[model samples]
Target: MSRTLPALRVTALAACLLTGAVLTHPALAATRAAAPSPAQQKLDRLADQFYVARAKFDPLLYATANGDSRYDDQIGMAISPVVRAKQFAQYHDQLRQLHMIARAQLPEKARLNYDILEFEINSQLDLEHFPEHLLPLNHFENVPSVLANYASGTGSQPLTTPAQYRAYLSRLNQLPAWIDQAIVNMKEGIRVGVVQPKAIVMKMLPQFQQLRSSTPEASIFYTPIKNLPAQFSAKDKEELTAAYRQAVERIGPALDSLCQFLESDYMAAARASSGYGDLPNGAAWYKARIKNNTNLALTPQQVHELGLKEVARIQRQLAELGPKLGYTGPANQLPQWVAAQDKFKPFHTEQEVLDAYRKIYATVDAKLPNYFSLLPKARLDIQLEPELTRATASDHYTPVAADGSHPGVFWAVVNDPAKYSNVGMTSLLLHEGVPGHHLHAALLKELPLPDFRKFYTEHPSAAAYTEGWALYCETLGREFGFYDDPAPYYGHLNDELLRAVRLVVDTGMHAMGWSREKAVAYAMQVLGYSEARATNQIERYMVWPGQALAYKVGALKILELRAKAQKALGPKFSYPKFHAVVMGDGTLPLPILEAQVDKWIASQK
Candidate 1:
């Protein structure tokens, strides 16, 4: 996800107030009558320390994305043993300090912040037992792939200023060393029997090859130099361009080296098995992933069983809806029938595809106020995915800049517009644009929460709540009047079925010993995905085990909470208030969110 925040300038006195430090300044002492409790002060100090330390020691992008520019000139070694040790030490120390705080003494808002910070700290500490750094690069998310986007001048990394350009060049100069470290970590993974599946390794090879260009000018890393602002002087442009070209030239060999290593040494060591269960301590690792992604104590078998029931439930609906759309096919064949329909593939150009999404946005915007009192200040913009990453990337949402400098972007992957089905367009817009990710994410940033909470959605701990809320938003299409047509309604069901299918197939492969081919075949049968598409989705699950499960698991919890609220409040129930409560405090863990919802329900009574 792309992350950028508005600049928050904190003066020394303001910083003291933020961290709950004692105010002895006469100007402030005269105005203040009561001081915060000691426990509250301790909690605030610990939270502030952890937040700043994370920005410094964690990935540089985490800081840069949040408008913290302290690490802009350095690409820190996130996967190195030394860095990992330091990160673990920091988390342990912070946890110790947090334990000393008296949670009962804090007010409701401070307690909420404490709970979130505690969850974040514990989540980091959980990784200390695992060797995640050893298996770092994946087809879905890797350093080189992300850095290429930063260099392309279109991603979260800013290239508007000369200093930004210089910082990027510094990062490019560091590329070789980072690639060398990844190789070292992968070698360790091989020794420890924690290698990626061969299928995933094969996917990474092509990505590295894509990053290598014949010359600096043709490289993605040269993009910023080419697009240098007109305000830059001739001398500034010349020096920066020369520096960028040299940096890009240096990066080519590094990419080629890594690509060659993966092709040869790494490929030979790659595991034939697809699931995490096949690795050393694989089952336990998969369990950790499930807990991290879903924030639930559900076992793999339970999740798998739940998925089976959900799939059956959604399939029954599809079977019933098929006849209305003039399809008399069996339930399993519904997706294929829908795919074959000419009416679904209406767009012939990218602009036509974009316009369709915009039209849906307009339709949803008019009806939003009826159901949502809490709306994002940031406007949503729809754009086609960039060519460099479009092939591997799905349509997704990028967060809005906190300062509203840039609108939230819904990137539609329209590689071949003629082949892009219009069936799911309305549901997709709702999920990724208006009331889905864009609304949830932008509103979180705008909340009067700690900086850590404002930026918390990027972490794995918040995945369930954020993704669940987005999936739930798709169901809102019915209330918004976008699903009156049978086609659009089918789209909603199709999307829901895909999430349900993920729960089953993800657990089946990682926990039940299902092969990659078996999982792909299951998706193709149920979701009517092409062989290539099914393989892509399955491989994604293989690389990021249990992540796909978040959508279904999270959505079901929200839906259940809403049902409880409706039953209890009856006539007093309000969609606007319920939505506001769900979204008002930014992203939260599932249990905390449920507790918040229950509290709101009681308040109405």
Candidate 2:
């Protein structure tokens, strides 16, 4: 939060672009001034080169997901000291080059691009101060689990062509090296007293154990072999099959070795304290994370206070809804009664759950055009999360591939239908399906934006913009008439309350020294979450500090901006146009989005 782009750069770039040269004849100049300024031309060239550099710097996993095949053969490990130092140097060099540009001399859009690039480079630099690489893999972000998904042929990494097939094998061959580097980094973290919480480690070891297979066919690495194209030559198929067996043989032992290290050695060293603040200079680190995730200059206490108010307000609303739902008791106990009701937990089979989500998608898909003028062209499909990971997985959306070879996927983790409440199903579909991530992410690909903007996954400040937009989309159900039903309305409120609870508990765990148990207790007591659900939620916040805060903070900002626009424009305010403004620039920091909204409001006048 302390470091920011210089104001001089902003002013200088705009001035140089707008007033650098004066035409002798104003009339002739007006018609002939269609060409961009010299600063814009330079900025355009820099943007092109930046994307090239970004491609080389991207993690191999993200590169594969982005459909950039250039890095398929390279399992780029940034965990090692040598690699991390190089990454730091490269980021610094990019930052230096960005500083050279007269940001103020550029056009509006170009200047915004410059600011985004600067934020990304600076954020990467900021990350180097912490030992994040040491505690790299968690239950939430286990690389092996990700690799298994990809290898199992259900993920984004395409294995259609022979070249793509070989690329997959090459990546599998490099898994051992990635595992080795992670072990080294974990040891370094232990040496320096930075590690994941023991709770996460306990959960993670079982995942690795599940990945270990005795036979090649039984192994996840053998997934591609099962789906080999019939068009391949017999000799090529034989060679690939042998190679895959070898890779599986190698990967199996590596998985066991890594699991052993984590269970026996690293587990002992894992941090008992959940907060990042417990580490060296952790307070400042967590504050930077808050800024990074929220893209706002808010202190933890300020966020905490805001969260408390929101919780109280939502609880009041829940109380108001209770009598309407035939429950006249206290609001806090409403969720318990709702959970116990046979009507809310109506799904008796997994198929019923799938059918319910599909119906929700159909319902929302038909209503989207009423609220949004700009809709995604890409298709979205609903699928059940794989049984292997569904127990831990939440309902999530995977963006469509940049090439459109794959559609956006909305995966519902229907671990047990009898236990899964259908109350939040409508809100979940809206957030994860038609008008939430599927719409926002797929539309970004169709935008006339830079390739870097369209494809990258680990962009510096995207969570709040994207996730907040999804959360905001949840509120749209009311406008579309989905919340007229009491159950769905209660679900919407529960979802909103969940985000509010995140802000309180996320900051509480990281900044205010709340214990894991306290955070879990607060979640269960206030949100009516089950013990296991509360534990998982708290542990997620523990591992990834400040990320949960993005949802509430981002949604609030969007809501606030929409209110301001409606107030300013009054009769001229258009909901569709306002939505277009928010999403027009693709994913942006909330501050940039607010500015865009303000500009749209002025145009309406």
Candidate 3:
């Protein structure tokens, strides 16, 4: 089998054809056939070059993640200047041309290629425009913080060999510069009005200071060194032990410095202001970010309004379930019932957490045939988020490749499995696993589109279509005879409520001038999230503002579109055909998706 696009970043390459003057000459057309245009020939050659490029490329994302020699010499560091510049220019150049082709009536393959290319281009451009660097190190994904966990040698990177251990040492040593640059960039954001809210920065102090711990053994990053590889020569192990200590000395001090600066300087300097739009050039920056992310011309107010409608609709459902779950007496009692449910209580152990996720997958799968025309070829598994990452992460999906070599993963943060509630598992499973990302992405990767088209771009249609569809799935519990248990069905709506709350809270943070505290408070009280989980989600929105908006906004639009398609086609609509069309040619812009569906509907007649 051919290699798949490695990490699935949006990407594209274009082939343009030109017209010859002779082709435009009436006399030539009347008397003789036209000769080939050089531009047309060059464009064809460019297309061929693109194909060759695709064949040769398997993006080294895999090697980077594993710390393979493919980049063993390269330091596995983040926040570098050179890396960001090339990323910006390469994507900028590709998109400028790709957009040119998109405006043309090109062949279906060419349009698909350009569409995918546009997505890749946008992903790169998103960084430069957003003040992401301002709050570069969230408690969750900041590289310096994560390295301490990776240094523990329990993460994805291989630390088995003595040389591999040293390579990690080298990566650890590079942290001071990375953090220095990150601080510098963030300051730039400050001057320009790009800044993270002080609320998140306050939460960050404990995380970084935790790494500044007095003993290397006490540091989270020092765990790997605490245990040496048994196979290493004693002398080599001794040297590695020294090296690991030295690296941590370097990293530990940096973390401590970060802690000191964060406690004394950074948080003070951070804006009490919440939105990026509060910064200089803020509105334009926010607009560009929204457009790039949602792939539509949408205002914050528009999205804010969208969030409200979804919240109300979901609240109505929650009211209906409150009685079944012992929220008897009144509709208002539902929130009280939701808050008090023992079933909504988190797992007390990791096994319980995994078992809960497993139950969700099994229960859903048992009823899968009623909803899906496609399913992933690979199995799904649940695991604890790596200790290195769990502190910073919630839940996430890692999709399998086209070859079905990797199983789709539903990684829950099992460190605090007691914080893992069963109430949200069903809807969360739908979003991350079957009929959500895995099914949509795996099938798209397997489709007959061009290499770039298949893997690069995630069409607005897919996320809005698939996620919204899954959110809709949570509502379909009774239809499948699953949510009749009341608990699981409540779990399904709890998941749906989370997405709906994302709508309100995301908009509240970025658009309505809601403080981070206000966002979390609303989430805790109204959305029924625990203080710890609410803190994680709220901080995530602060670090990356508009992204949270996409989930509910996209999902709601898809549900609306599906209703439209169902109405237009009536009995003629085939669920299988509807799905095939949605998944067939890779991701699509929502407008194009609607058009594609409209065309498909016409074709049926």
What is the TM-score of each predicted model, taking all chains together? 0.92, 0.91, 0.78
Number of the top lDDT candidate: 1
For every model shown, the clashing-pair count is: 0, 9, 7
Off by over 4 Å in 1: 1-35, 60-74
Q: Rank by lDDT, descending?
A: 1, 2, 3
Candidate 2: residue 224 Cα off by (Å): 1.6
Query: For residues 47-72, what per-residue lDDT tens digits would candidate 2 score against the true structure?
Result: 66666665655445445555455665
RMSD of 1: 5.8
Per-model C-alpha RMSD? 5.8, 7.0, 8.7
Q: After superposition, how far is residue 58 of candidate 1 from its true place, in Å?
A: 3.6
lDDT against the true structure, each candidate: 0.82, 0.78, 0.59
- For candidate 2, the C-alpha RMSD (Å) to the true structure equals 7.0
Worst 10 residues of 1 by lDDT: 1-10
Collision pairs in model 3: 10-120, 10-456, 12-117, 148-221, 152-224, 423-491, 468-555
Residue-level lDDT of model 1, residues 168-277, one tens digit each, is: 88888998899999999999998899899999999889988998898889998888987999999899999999998998888888888899889998999998888999
As a TM-score, model 1 comes out at 0.92
